[model samples]
Target: MAVLTGVSHAAEPLALCFAPPHAVAPDVRSQWQQELRLILHHSGYELKLAACTPESIELRVLRSNPRQPQALGAARTSQSRIEPVVEIYLDPLAELIGTRLAGPLGRAMARVTAHELRHVVGQQAHHQGGDFPEGYSAGLLLAAKPAHFRIR
Candidate 1:
């Protein structure tokens, strides 16, 4: 299913929006959203992000599970098709980034978010290669900086 060249690898601009995270700082949210946008753009998408409508494919930022602070998050899917709702935890994201290299926490969060999103966009399963890797590591999250993530 290789697209080859001069072909699009993404769905035509879908209604992909994000739910504003409660109790999260505005600046952090802004940086996260901006970085997420840039990553998706670089990864070849033209999604129309906005406040969630019932029909929109929404990425909701939620509070982290206190017991699993290091856990990134998950995307809900039905059958083989990804569902409209994708949830990620901000507190855990910050915890994963940790105090080391705290500067890029927001940017790093974008990568983590994009990781989950690719699962939806590419209709991919874990470890199917590309952005849907088997798992994440601190080194990858903190040190690695790919120009753009691959979808497949």
Candidate 2:
């Protein structure tokens, strides 16, 4: 759960939060949380984990005319709204739970979550292209290997 600010020069404030894992299998939940935390730590943002009312997250993206390449192009813009509560569902019951694939998948979700938070904070316009830094990718997160026990 990380929240970034100033994604783009003209984007609205954004917030990225992580919903508690609701995996039926304890091990799976633990793994998922761990991977999420790793990516969040590297995202260079703040984390806020609290209870909310609504059960779903709200994300909005608006496309504007492209700006000049060289000159400080116009700032990008964005808007986001997160419900009070987080929606939770059973984790996928796949045999790859504790394998290399599981780690990468969890890392990918974490990256996406962090990427979204950057939008909320106003770092980038939306979750596309190389707008974000290089390390946001799952391969990088895995290669770096975060030290924390669980994804916060």
Using TM-score, give the best candidate's number. Answer: 1
lDDT of 1 by residue, 21-41 (tens): 545566766766677766666
Deviation (Å) of 59 in candidate 2: 9.9
- Give the clashing pairs for model 1: none
Off by over 4 Å in 1: 1-14, 66-69, 100-103, 129-131, 146-148
Task: Provide the TM-score for each candidate, comma-separated.
Answer: 0.74, 0.37
Consecutive 10-residue window with the lowest summed lDDT within model 2: 87-96
Give the true-structure RMSD of model 2.
12.7
Measured on C-alpha atoms, candidate 2 has an lDDT of: 0.36
- Clash count per candidate: 0, 22
